[model samples]
Target: MTTRARASTMAVPAQRRLQSWIKQSRGYLFIAPAVIFLLVVMVYPLANVFVTSFTQIDTRERTQEYVGLDNYAALLDDSTLWNSVRNTVIFTAASVVLHLLIGGVLALLLNEQWLSAEVRNFTRGVLILPWLFSTAASALIWGLLYHPFGTLNYLLMSSGLASEPVEFLGDRALALMSLVLVNVWKTFPFYMVMILGGLQSIPVELYEVSRVDGAGRLQRFRHITLPMMRPVILAISTIDIITTFGHFDLVKLMTFGGPIRSTETIAYYVWQTGFRDVNFGYGAAISVMMVVVLSIGVLVYLRMFTAREQMYGETTTAL
Candidate 1:
């Protein structure tokens, strides 16, 4: 081709690219405000914490000094930090597992076709009551139930299950587990709602077809239900893990990480170090570490989810 002809052809591609860029820019423009808001509220705070973590701040003197990784180095030798890490792991794991198990079972039961609409509706409303309560309110309610002379001890004593009141929130052995129970109670409803929505979205025809093929309840659940619900379960579990890991309010209100710090999670440690002890640099280091751990967990979950989705898609395409 001649030079002019080749140039015109190249210009045609450039013109198309420009038009495509303009089209994409409109979508970006729509989201620019939200993106800007997030940067201001979320990104700025996170960046500030990261910067603060490397400094030694003296609030009394109103001073900041670059201390390199001294804050993190101090965390390495801090036995309380290690203890808090252990507590955080136990609390997060137990809460997530119980939430999934109890929530899954309830969602399954509630999805049953034999249940009357009124009964189902009422049961759902009641089950979701826990999710309606704020963290502070949940702490207060569970606190009352767990009081030494409270309803739980009364029931136990009256039923001959115990000879004395149990110090649910005051005993080191029981405090962590007691807090776990409250966390489960308050958060399971979230899993239930998400799972229930997933269940409802499933086509009834799939179950009917399985039954016609001589599949039993367990078989149908294993093959049809589980595979379909995997995405929802994974998504919710990831969210639960992050939230439970950072949980603080219940421990703060009910136990105050008491009875020798049995319930002192990393989150509580951060607050204690920063506000109560007035060690802002150390607290910021702890906070940054938490963000790192959570980011790693979320990345793993996302990788698993993406792999499973790809495999499922390929399987569908093959069939």
Candidate 2:
């Protein structure tokens, strides 16, 4: 080949490669702000937590000392840790289940054509009002509702449902469940909105086709709705589980982890241990353990996502 021809050929590919690199770099540049924000807000704090977990942080003395695995050992021996875990597990399970079932029902109901478009939109907006309220505000509102002479008790008594006021928060037997109900009321709207969005995305033609195949409402829901909503269900459920498991403020504000610590959770325990008791080392250990526990959930979610993607990819390629 001639020297000029060789140079020209090399120049074309080099320029093309440079252009490709620039295009890829532009995409990264767009995401760079988000990446930087995540590092500063999430990654850095988490790295700090991991490091702090191995150290003794004395707030009064203003000192931090490396203590290694002693904190982890203390956590293993702590009875309250197990209790908090139990409460957290129960809270998460009940909250997530109710969120899914009730949210699914509300989403399905809201999707119906029976309501006028304006009415439906207005109703959806009202339902989300609970979710938009700050957690502290919602907790305070529920605290009022749970009081002996509160609106709920007065209505119940006046309607002959109960003759006396019910101490919802003070009764140990009822405290946890009472708190769960309040949390569900506050957060279920988020699930409803998410599932409603999922429902909207479902092809209307599928429902029509199912009807033509002589499927009833229940059958259509089973065969069409449930199957199609699998992805949304997985995503929302994973998010809710983590949040519910780590839930602190509402329980803290409403019950103060009270009625003999029956409603105390992992997050509350961590806060008490680290902040209240000033046992920063032990609290950091609890915090680390909580992350390890939550990681199991994240792993499960990732596995489901991967499996779904593989199945979807296969189905797409086959078609």
lDDT of 1 at 75: 83
TM accuracy, model 1: 0.88
Q: Please, what is the whole-model Cα lDDT of each candidate in the order they appear?
A: 0.91, 0.88
Cα deviation of 182 in candidate 2 (Å)? Answer: 1.3
TM-score of each: 0.88, 0.85
lDDT of 2 by residue, 1-319 (tens): 9999999999999999999999989989999999999999999988998898899986878999999899998988899999999999999989999999989899998999989999999999998888888988888898898899899999999999998888899898888998889889998999999999999998999999999999999999987887778778878988898888889987778888888998999999999988899887888889989999889877876677658767765221211
| Model 1 weakest lDDT span, ten residues long | 310-319
Residue 104 CA displacement from its true place in model 2, Å: 1.0
